[model samples]
Target: MRQPDIEIYLKDGDQQAVTDWLNATIGPCTPWRRQGQTFKCQAANGAPVTWLPNAVGKWHSLFIESERTPWEDDPAFARAAFAALGVEIRCAPGGWQEEDGIDAADRWIKINGEGEQEFIWRTQ
Candidate 1:
């Protein structure tokens, strides 16, 4: 079966920086022109992507809602985002599941400020 859609979160980074990276690496990204999204773009492989800022937190969401997304998976995107943005990144380990055991639902694979990948339990 095809892999699920990729969802990654940014802990801290300027929206413009993210926009620039997306425009350069993915495809030309334009202002979302929608109520909730910050930007909207298509990946090179033709997947729809959106950047959404959290209303009340440092974390922001990026959804690549197609199996055709360029990156292979969440960690791959996280690594690329870190290389481009030089900021912390987070994603559910191995993608999110309907019933992920071992309390993995709340766990994340984080790319830290220094670009080290580690498992973390996020409280916020």
Candidate 2:
């Protein structure tokens, strides 16, 4: 079975900064090629990744499309990103499930000020 894609959202940081951080953390990626509003590149592990800067409000969305990515899941990526970029990052708690539906519960895992992951349930 295909592994679930890893998704994460950044609270802040420009495109260049995010690309740089990804290179350093997940190993160097190929030069970013823009495709409309999103930028795509291949991670060191050969996973296809895309970065959509400011895709959601002020948060930048990133998607790891393949299981080849070095990290195992969203929280793993968020932890590494928070450490490297020192920025708040958000991701679905325990990854996303279609059965839950897009508006189902709307819980998230966000990095706190003390660099800890916190689970938050959005009322909306």
Candidate 3:
């Protein structure tokens, strides 16, 4: 099957980095769930959110949309994506960061802190 769009978000709401990534990849998925959207239910992570997954994996997501996704941000999913990816994403005073690095044995996206985020691509 074809790959789906990858998405990112800035707490700052600049959308520049997300836009750049969008241009290079499949496409960006607009947030169907926003701050004011109707409360569908409390997420597994306990975040009050709206919307549900329209499809399964293939795209990178900044937030959790479904239990099928394997992201550490979605703590209660099947297994911690961190466990599968072997990368630990942590949050600190600065921002979201990752130091464990993506594991060669698995696929992971680590969150190191809350500010000044970065990407550690597979090649690097």
Specify the highest-lDDT model's number.
2
Tens-place lDDT per residue, model 2, 1-124, is 3346888888876677878887877799998899999999998988888998887778899888986765688888778778777888887757556888866548788885776655665634
Instruction: Give the Cα RMSD of candidate 1.
Output: 2.7
Deviating ranges (above 4 Å) for candidate 2: 1-3, 102-105, 115-124
Ranking by lDDT: 2, 1, 3
What would the per-residue lDDT of candidate 3 be over residues 17-83, giving only the tens digit for each residue? 4333322332333443444422233333333323322212322234434332222333222123223
1 versus 3: better TM-score goes to: 1
In model 1, where do residues sit more than 4 Å from their true spots?
37-45
Clashing pairs in 2: none
Instruction: List model 1 lDDT by residue over 1-124, tens digit each.
Output: 3457887888866778887888788677545556554667666666777778872288888888887756788888888998888888888767666767657777778887665655656554
With a 3 Å backbone cut-off (N, CA, C), the pairs that clash in candidate 1 are none
Between prediction 1 and prediction 2, the one with superior TM-score is: 2
Worst 10 residues of 3 by lDDT: 1-10
Question: Which portions of model 3 miss their true places by more than 4 Å?
Answer: 1-16, 19-28, 31-62, 70-124
Q: Which candidate is the best by TM-score?
A: 2
Query: Candidate 1, 91: how far from true, in Å?
Result: 1.1
Better of 2 and 3 by lDDT: 2
Q: What do the candidate models score in CA lDDT, each in turn?
A: 0.74, 0.78, 0.30
